[model samples]
Target chain A: MPGPDLLSSQGLRLDGRRPNELRRIRCKLGVFAQPDGSAYLEQGNTKVLAAVYGPHQASKSKSLQDGVVVNCQYSMATFSTGERKNHPRGDRKSQEMSMHLRQALTAAIKTELYPRSQIDIYVEVLQADGGAYCASVNAATLALIDAGIPLRAYACACSASMAWRNGQPEPLLDVGHVEEAAGGVVLTVASLPSTGSIGLIEMSHRLHMDYFDVVLSRAMQGCKDIEVILDRAVREHLAEGWTKQDVVVI
Target chain B: MFQVRKLANLTLFVTTTPTKRYNKINKSDCFENSILPVHFSVYFIFHRTKDYNSCKNMTRHVKIRLASERVNHSVSSNNELPRFYTPGEVITGMQDFMRGHGTYAEDDSLKASVAGVMQKVNKLICIRPLKSRYVGEIGDVVVGRVLEVQQRRWKVETNSRLDSVLQLSSVNLPGGELRRRSEEDELMMRKHLQEGDLISAEVQSVFSDGSLSLHTRSLKYGKLSQGILIKVFPSLIKRRKNHFHNLPCGISVIIGNNGYIWISPQEKSNLVEGDKDEIANVETQTVSRSERETMGRVKNCIAALVASKMMLDDTSIMFAYEESLKYEEVKDLLDTEAMLDVAFLTQHKINYVDED
Candidate 1:
């Protein structure tokens, strides 16, 4: 038996959505004023808050002649996850997250305009479910846009998983904590969903060589879906006129 | 008196719980968050961990300077306690503290990066969890106490800088007049709910100023009964929600990840039976029997350490909860497959009944 009752006989996943359905996405930009830019986003129970501190002076070590140094820090709240973490940041896991963040956001930000400058994009994950990294990248993108930092396009991220239930390979969308822990093949894609160009993609565990296309395609589809939602949020945030996220005077 | 100084990392006036309270830093300046409270005060600057360690290693002398008072010092504690530093003066005191007793080498940028904090005559001490968590955010579920009830709204002290308001309308008795009362419900005058009623509520909003407002809307989040409430450091409790499901009918345990937990009999169970420890080996204290019970394993070790007064923190909680989880009742509830699942021949239900 592959697995009991992950996809129902009706062909819906555990949370009763079709295999293609992503989690509910609700986002708001300008959630806070104390930062140059800020945004809060909720994807299912996963909540992420992002604050952009500067396009201020570049530190001596970080300055680049051709572009701005986009400094990104990703920190999950200690109580954000089911398991309690002793230290929230400055830890190895967070260091890895920080590095991943810098990688993803540096790609997204158009740094050439702000040459010899630094933009600090700090992402704080208040609550974490499964897709924290994807949520962080999405939230940080919104924060940078809210901060009025120029970007190539919305850098949206999403993850997909595949479980061969009932002898047929089924691609899962926006994999949640349960499926993630179930040791399925997870494919995470960070893409300029508008143009269908992937910036980053990671896979955990292995899948049948044949199932890679379906899984990667579903994850890219998730990225495109996320880009729509994020784009709408950016428009609504811009249409609302003055947002608090752009007003961090300090 | 120009109460010109706000106590930042550097400025504090530790008096002998002193009578001569002046904003002008004379000889009686105290260290910030006094390690010792009385007699002498020093204005030590806030140094980072490495910085403090380096300074502690150095025996170099630093000069102390006092600013000339714009107003002549008249900090008279009249018939009433003196209104020492005006708020503006306190802010100024904080600024002066930020400017650590002037030195050619002093760097304002270094200290300014650290938030300039100030406090009263007795350095207002703050328990900053360097890794401290933010207490509450909007829409978070929290369990708190009705510490000071005024009007219709009860001031609930959630895990935050200030207490939040839980209006009477948000809560219902077994049955109440209003199905759901409007905001018109008088906050200052409540129909029911006195001080000290332990209630469960949702954080409604966090004011820009960092105050909180909570609501007790759901049937599940309301008055607690039939059990005890334990308060620990809010940060100690994890702030994630999980259904402690399969809770025995007689017991309903509402644990706030914020370390405030409310336990009550589910209108079925009574607690009079008391927590009788079927603790094996209390009489004999042997290895074989003690190892059989998880509590026996830890109770012996921790009691030894505590008897020796070795301070315990995270490592201890892990060890303690690990052992505690092994109890048949707890293992049944927790089902920690990784740490637990050691077979005990005698089949029994899990202990430490956890209600999700």
Candidate 2:
């Protein structure tokens, strides 16, 4: 079984989509003033607030690095999901997410510029509908910008799931938890969309050897499509200035 | 007579009124009408009137919309505003200050304010609403409710957090220099004043903790010589602490925002129709504190009488109160155990609830 007959007979995936369409994305930057940078992003009903702390100093134990060290912390609020979790962070899942976040974020950051310093990225999921990791990455990207951290390009992540329709391979973008639970081959790709290069790719569940490239490319394309929207938002945000209207006197 | 017949019908007098239709039960049974709910808002839901067969316990839902009708003066009360507010954050619906991240301190001069942990950590927040009260400054007109008779003075519950003292000298009795009101004055005073009476007064001085000390040493405000009284929430009456408010036709005194109103008719009656007109003028022409107390009592009586379906104007309200006040028999009945309890009404097989 190429995973539980992923596509329904109506040519729709488990969550009802024509496979390639992505979930809605709503993002806001500079939502908080205390932090160097902050952003609020909602991918569908999943909401995440990302805050960037520093490029300041390398604290005692974790100091020596050849280049600027990227530290990422991923935590979810207890009430964010349908089944509330007892612990917000320090869980194995969150630890794994932190590692994955560093890998993708480091690819997009110009880490060499600030040698021996640390950039701390913290993402907290407030509400979780689905595609939480992708949302965290997108939100963190905006927060890094708000923190005035240097980036090579906007780092956007999107997921694609392969739904095996009647004799044809269908691709689903931004697979929600419901669709993921429905047992499709989910392929998540984190990339610098403009450069058309994959920063990170992870797949759960197995598809045909030949269909892997198609699924991976579709996920990458979803990332690129998201980058365009996010870049436009960032430009508009920077051009318009911060929210607490900067008082100007002529 | 024809108007009475028309009012008896379920359908109102072809011309619709918000209160007239629902007030049939109120007018016929104008006993001691005390409006239970002080807060009247868009969200005021009418609860089902439960059945309890008794006289004292009997309660009917009475809602009256009195737009117009004139009255007397009252003393004004006030509330102290916080010296400072949280920057960018708003304190809404209640007394609690909303502490946002933006609030800052100016070294030792400013206080360090932080949002309470539980308040911010939780998803829901609750704030209790506060009613506005009177702040006694240099000079302000206020309305006060006579709470207790102490010596020659009456302790008037002004809208301020503190109770004000209404001295005997400030009140205008029939003769100007009628030195010392006696026990006979307390007994016969209901003819001129009583419990729950609304009177308009003036803020003589501030009694330390922002409470008002009132005086009505003026002709315009003193004793309910005439006109109606009303009781309402203490917050609605807005008073600008000033002396002498002379309106076009008459004068008005703002009692604390609560519902105490003392209204005396202007010499020339500028005739108007319905409760709609007076509501527009509630904040106009400051009623003295003493007059507000007098008027608030009358409005309560009207609210009760009107709620019970009695189409009584200023004349009938006074008639009922006068009839009830001077009646030694009714006062005696009020003392009886059977009358005090639900026993009498229940024995008579009347389906009513007792006053709890």
Candidate 3:
């Protein structure tokens, strides 16, 4: 359990963010010329670059008859953290992060449209602040959109922490590194806000049953807010990359 | 003349000193005036700092810019912009219209599945993405690299979602056009069109799974040798009746519908019927230095057009090639400002033709 230092006297988190304010997000799509689709996203201090290749023919071992295989790899840079790490990927944490990423991304991609194909998504974390998973999910969604892959809706992920203000439980939106290290219960939710569906929900540490509802709802709200930002970014990219063929048809 | 002298002095300073401190100062100075000449000197400085041993009279300049400094080369037309759509955005009620390519029907509403402008023909509504893998239609021309030589078919990568198939029977053998395929031909598959060889073919049929079957029955479509291939977004390739162009500037170009452009020197002699042995020696002939230079200029011109996301066709490419002659050196056109200038001039010529 964390002390009352989780929230200041004015009901702000340790990073001076209000209970419901998300961190600033800056994103760009199609950053790389080689990949089918690529995106770079920054959420507060966490920067993630995602590249998506294929919907092309899948290998024999991974081919599916009814739908496309979603392959996800999550790797962090050796110097991304406070201390220099030796292994960048293939450890226990990266494998689990890769699985979680596939789950959230697969739920949004329209797999049935591409039969016997595969989409490979590679996410490289340059800087890992708190909510790295959330930023990874958001960046992968943008990459999928850039690839022109069909999607049911935008898959957005956001993290929230439970803080107490004057003996009242307040759910903090968009947890930061300081709040995460302070040992508060963090709830991470990846959801399709437009479809009103939850792709994945993960909770770290323990939270009371009554507090779970508020924390989950706050994370869901943050996803909805992120969907708006992502939608705008996609529009801006479309405007810049559109050619004469797209406009002359109308 | 003044710019030439400035360029000469800059290169002299770079090649003579070749120190880290001088290189650092030279890089910033060249970046400020990033025209054609400065681009060459900057390339020289980069070569000196990285590979001191191999620093000969290298004149090639490769421009590297930060992501924040990237220039948006998209040319916005004066016409009214189309209404764009994003994924999951509702296009219309499903009651009156049928969903097409990039749209999906859900909950009595037609929503777009890709981000782009919407197109409607009668009651069908489709949203086309600005960029995607090539979707082959019947009779579409494509250039593909041979990936695998299967039993009687060769797997081709045509920038499509699935690998295209080129059956052994579809290709016209060097001996004759109407020869039947025998087991000998199956054994000689790798010798004819092995892995990593590029060929121009036409889409014969589309499979139910969306893969394309290509054919190289025509004499014009066959093995491409001694050429430069430039790939751009498939959407930028404007469909035309003739994808092959023998430009007046002594070169031939094959603009594959799959967005692969092959710029090669014009063939001196047309292949006569039943000239089987002559086909073997085509790859061995040496291309002249002048022809190679022209091909390089054409390739750089195509790159410039691709940078601006312009529609690629024979006319636009020829216009760009003509506009690029002012730069003198082929490498000069690689500079961003020079590229933009060529693209702008070509666009102006294209618009002029359209108005006339």
**Per-prediction DockQ scores?**
0.01, 0.01, 0.56
lDDT of 1 at A16: 81
Model 1 residue A186 lDDT score = 75
As for lDDT, the candidate ahead, 1 or 3, is 3
DockQ of candidate 3 against the true complex? 0.56
The CA lDDT at A49 in model 2 is 96
Docking level of model 1? incorrect
Stronger candidate by TM-score (1 vs 3): 3
Write model 1 residue lDDT over B162-226, tens digit each, in one string. Answer: 46677666666434536655554554234355577777777777765455678777756666533
Model 3 agreement with the true structure over B260-340: per-residue lDDT tens digits: 889999977676745657766678778899999999999999999999988999899999999999999999998888998
Quality of candidate 2 docking, DockQ: 0.01
What tier of docking accuracy does candidate 2 attain?
incorrect
By summed lDDT, the worst window of 10 consecutive residues in model 2 chain A runs over A241-250
TM-score of chain A of each: 0.92, 0.91, 0.97
Query: What are the candidates' interface root-mean-square deviations?
Result: 20.6, 22.8, 1.8
Q: Which run of 10 residues does model 2 chain B get worst, by summed lDDT?
A: B70-79
Error in Å for residue A243 of model 3: 1.4
A1-250 per-residue lDDT for model 2 (tens digits): 4447656798776667667777788888767646667899998888999998766445557755556778999999999988999989999999999999999999977676555467789999999877888999999988876565556567899998876677777777888888778777778888877667778888887677998888888888898788877766665554333111111211
Q: Which stretches of candidate 1 lie over 4 Å from their true place?
A: A1-5, A242-250, B1-356
Across A137-169, the per-residue lDDT of candidate 1 in tens digits comes to: 999888776665545567889999886666788
